[model samples]
Target: MLETTMPALASLEAFGNVTDLLVRRAADAPDHVAFDVPADDPASWRPVTTAAFLGDVRALAKGMMGAGLVAGDRVAIMAPTRYEWAVADLATWFAGGVVVPVYDSSSASQVDAIVHDAGVRLAIAGSRAHADLLTRALVGTDAIGTWAMRGVDGIRSLDDLTGRGTHVTDAELETRRTLAGHHDPATIVYTSGTTGEPKGAVLTHSNFLGQVLNIAAAYREVVTPTGNTIIFLPLAHVLARGLQLICIASGMRIAHLSEPSRVVPALSVLRPTFLVVVPRVLQKIQAAAADKAARMRLGPVWERAVSTAVARGRLAEKQDAGRRSRAPRGLRVRGAVFDALFYSRLRAIMGGRVDYILSGGATLDGALSLFFRGIGVPVIEGYGLTETTAPLTGNLPGRIVSGTVGLPLPGSTVRISPEGEVLARGVGVFAGYRDPRHDAEAFVDGFFRTGDLGRIDDGGRLILEGRMKDVIVTSNGKTVVPARWEGAVEASPLVQHAVMVGEGKPYLSALLILDPAESAAWAASHGSTFATGSPGEVRAIDEPRLRAHLQPTVDAANALVARSEQVRRFTLVLADLDDHELVTPTLKIKRREVLHRAADTIDTLYRGAAS
Candidate 1:
């Protein structure tokens, strides 16, 4: 096993607790814009200041008191990203209760699993639609009560709850706050179980406070008061929720969008300076750029422009004193030309102000990272899990290195085991899982086993290979790490999702999904015709035009791996993979689940049948 350690940055200092940061921000910058929620008028936005936000939270906390909520009580929120979701979260903390967040898109059974596991007694729903799911889950169970953020017939609204707390006094809330402390449980965030049942991860106020302060300090320039971000990921996700608190503590302005489909339109209007995203968003951006290039008939010219820009970007990063003088004259000329025609034009789509993108939840493609850097947008990839309070390592603002989750966080320590498993130990790491049975298998000598295979480089950057459980061994006794191959396959502009399959088999195989828009563009550029389908829907993959483009992508991916690890056969699913069944909400494929769902296809592939 290899081990490395880096001391915490000198500037790293602890904020007392989650609520303390909220109180300080409200008192220090009362008029600062805290959040901007969508207005019913559709053309305008509703801004909430820090002081006004605190008032709403305090009022809701008092309402909890009026309804007999006490210290250690569990409250669940079933909602999408919105202003009231923030209110409910803070109010639960202020009322000295533990908050349980449920994904807004979760089915009735999934909602029931969380509520029952956490013993949540009170739930706040975003709309009647969300409340309906909750009501169905709570049927025949008298332990839970529900409130909606928006009113419906015979239902209490959040506004009504605040009004009901009119008789509750400030002293009562203060008394409740004193009942909790740094080590007290603040939230019970569940794992996005891509495999088995979700396990509750109990994170304390201190865990959040430490991580937010250290991350803000490390990336002080990008996470300052001047930073503005629009959150589109589900708040139930640890990364999204942690970023929300980091923005609050750093006095940054934030906006919320519930629907993923609305992100592009919102980006054009919000002009956000930074973003918290997954690898899929970056992939989409790259695909969109390619589609636009194809539509404008700049096929070869577009590819050359991107290549020239990347060369210039890398040359500019060299620290040699004569680096600028050494740059070829032709490259400088092409860089300037492309900067005006291609790079600058692309920036307009993202409001032309995005400085950095904080990506997590999956490994990012190095080629995609450089492509964005070529266009003047830098993506800072990070690594973490819900058990670690969202982030264990992250790439910093000016020191980003493509394809590596930069140095470990200030207070965290990472180590690799003999079996190549990544382990972590830190104040941010949870004390233990909610289920005692998981603790033994999850911890080794006090370090929380991450279950991810990785190695630390000389620069202290963490390079993840793949998940330990997802590694496949073939009948020939060769081991294959699929994530390595999948990342390379995605770098090809033609494929959308790639899954490597071959366990206890003679050779590796793959499953590929193609984006319809991109396929159409490829077909057009290649002098072929394809039946245009509805926008964003999957098209039949067996068509000759698609097969012609996909073969090159598969070959390009094979060039990156050994012959034994290469995919010998592949099948195109021709349909969109359902989010809940084949993958988790964060877009991580449930390997076992996907393999099970496609058992027949696997059999056909081995039988040498044509796809």
Candidate 2:
């Protein structure tokens, strides 16, 4: 059994609770810009100083207290990513309430499960759309009072919630803020479980404080006030929320946008030093750049530039690993030329000064990781879940390995069990699930069973293979980790999801889901007519040209693994996953459920196989 632990840089013994981090910031640098709220002009954003932000939090916290919010009450924050969401989250903590974040995409049924499970007393919604959903979810449950970020037919807005506490005292709010100790439960974040209903992971003030303090210490250069980031991911996701806290701890200028579409305009305006990204977004940007290059008749130059970037990234990784000393001189010159001609523009697209782009939520494509590194912005990939306050392991700025998620975060221990399951224990680990029944299967001894299959590389980085349950064992007893090949194939823009099959069968095969937009782009590039519809209803699946296009992708994925583990055959489904439909709120596929639904298709794939 291989185990790795990164020592903690600091402890939270001096700090009473999570809210103290904000108070300290307010006291130290009261005028420093802490948050940038969108101004009336869509492109313009209004800066909120540390003092002003704290004042808002204090006011709202007092209002909640006046409105009968008692210590340890669970307040469900149901909303998209926005400024008010952050305010509500901090206010909830300040008011001695446990925040229960509900994804904007969550269905009413899902919301009902979480609300009842957490025994939520107050709910906050971002908009009328969310308010309506919250209203529906609250039906038949313990009657919970609801407030909206935007006022609705009869629902009071967050501003109204703030004004409700004219009688509440400042000292009372301070008392509530300091009430929770390090070990006290601060939030009950539900896991977006692929199988059963979501399980609420009870995270404490220490769970967050431990992560924030150590992470801010670990990346001191990047987490400083001069460094800043924007949050476009739903605050409901533990990763985004954890990042929000990290920024708060460091006094890093932070901003929020509800959707990915709104991120572009703010990028140039904010020029963030770092970014929060998902694998899908990385793939799209790469694909769009490639598509634009082709339209501009610079495809050859673009392709070569990409190759150079990958090569540069490869050499850098080797140097970091204490392998080769430096890049060949000729290669360096070529890379510089390409950087000037092509990569520089690509860097400019990300606001020209992004030091690193942090990625989580899913396994990023190794190829994409390398390409991005080659350009300038190294995708500092990390691995963790809601159970482990955002990151268990992450790559340091200069010590990145493209294909692997970096070393264990400070104060975290990552151990590969005898059965090859990844188990973790640390300051960041949550205080188990709200329901004790679920804890039995989740924790082994003291460590949380991550349910992921991975190995620690010689470089001490964590390279995730796939879910333990998702690993395929063929009839000949050859084991295969699907994500290795699937991620490679899905790196292609034309492919949205790649599900490796052949459990208890001869060899590995796959069910590839096509991205409609990417498929249309492919058709335009190929001079073929693209008919748009659902996979079963679309004629594109039967196109020989499309299959011919996918063949290289499968071949590339095959080359990554052994012959037995390679995808021998496959079929494409011209459909994509909808958030909370096929993909989880964290942006992971429901592999078991997807495969179960396609049982007939699997039979068809292996029907003519040789015994």
Candidate 3:
């Protein structure tokens, strides 16, 4: 068994409940801006000071207390990533209630499952649409009350809730806050359910404190008051929620972007020093950069530059390989020229000031990571499940490894089982799932079974091999890991998602979701008509000419793997695979869901000629 652990840092010992950070930050730096909310105009943002933020939390807590929620009661926050979401979240903790987060865009049935399972009675909605969703979710239920952040007809507004708190004294609120302990459930964050039913992890104050303090200590240089960060991912996800807490505890200046589609534009304007995101964002960035290069008729030169950089990267990773064995001087010169011409423009699009981007929730392709690093932006990959309270292992600034998930977080322990499953045990890990019955299946001995196959490298970095259940076995009995091929396929600018299917079938076939913009641009350049389709819909590309254009990308990906594992027959999907139903909130495609929904397409791929 391979195991590694980083001892807990001193910061973890200082907190009582996780909420203490807010109280302390407010006391120490009351005038410091805690968050920046975007105004109606996209170009401007409004700041919220620590003092004002705490006051809002206090008022909301009093309102929640006055509404009859007692200690241990669950209160749901159904909202997008916004200032009000943060206020409601902290207020729930201060009110001595467990925060049960619900995604603002979630369907009513999804919301209903979470609320009913968590036994939630009070939900704070971000908008009228969200209030309506919550209303539908709570129908025929225990008369759950709904409060909207924005004013809505017949729904109580956040202002109204805060107004009711005027009668409640400060001492009473303090008394309620004191009732919460380090072991109390801080939040019931539901998993995105990529594999199966979404399980609620019972994370405690200590669970979050462990992550926040360890991450702070690990990245102390970058976690500063002046650092700017934008919250664009769903706050409902553990990674984003944990990141929000980390930013608040570190006193970083934050901006919340409610729309995910506006992230790149907002980044250019906000010019955040650091960014935390899922791999999909990076994929999009890479695709756009490559598309632009191709449009400029610099594809061959760009490819050569990327190849040289990747070679240099691989050589540099070796023990005695640095400048001594770097790429040839001529190649390096050409790369530097291309970096100025192409890569710099890409960096400028992201505001040119990003120190380093921290990505988790999904694996970033190794080549893509190296390409970004070559272009002067380091995209660090981290790994963790929702049950681990955000991140249990990640690539920090100095110790980054391109393909690996760096090292275990300070205070966490990771071990590889005989079967290659990664098991974790530490303060960062949740005690268990919300359902006691799942404990036996989730934990092996004392370690939390990650259900992911991975190995610990000699350097102590963890390399994920993909989910155990996701392994595809052919009728010939050759075992294949789809993520291995999928990661390579996604590395191509033409592909958005490359899902391999053929479990118990003859050979592996792929369901390809081409990057619409890039594919369209390629088609247009090749003298073919690329028609537009509905929003997020992938337009049909069944023509032989389009397939011919995509063949080189497919051949490049196939070169990375063995013949059996290479995609045999392929079918192009006409819609974005990143759709909510097909992918998790964190952006990992739900392979089973996609296969089930696209059974007809899979059958067609198998029956049709190989692309």
Best by lDDT: 2
Cα lDDT of model 3 by residue, 87-136, tens digit: 99899999889999887667777888898899987889988888888777
The reply for model 1, stretches above 4 Å from the true place, is 9-16, 140-144, 320-327, 492-494, 515-541, 608-611
TM-scores for every predicted model: 0.93, 0.95, 0.93
Ranking by lDDT: 2, 3, 1
What is candidate 2's lDDT per residue for 505-550, written digit by digit as tens?
Answer: 9877888878877787677877876555663231226668899978
Clashes of each: 0, 0, 2
Candidate 2 TM-score over all chains jointly: 0.95
TM-score attained by model 3: 0.93
Off by over 4 Å in 2: 140-144, 319-326, 524-540
- Give the Cα lDDT of each candidate: 0.80, 0.85, 0.81
Q: Which pairs clash inside model 3?
A: 538-574, 538-575
After superposition, the stretches of candidate 3 with alpha carbons farther than 4 Å from their true spots are 308-332, 516-541, 576-579, 608-611
> What is candidate 3's CA lDDT for residue 425?
92
- Minimum summed lDDT over a 10-residue window in model 3 is located at 315-324
Full candidate order by TM-score, most accurate first: 2, 1, 3
Error of 1 at 597 (Å): 1.4
Candidate 1 structure quality by residue, lDDT tens digits, 142-219: 544788998677677888777778888899887886577778898998887876778899999878877887787788
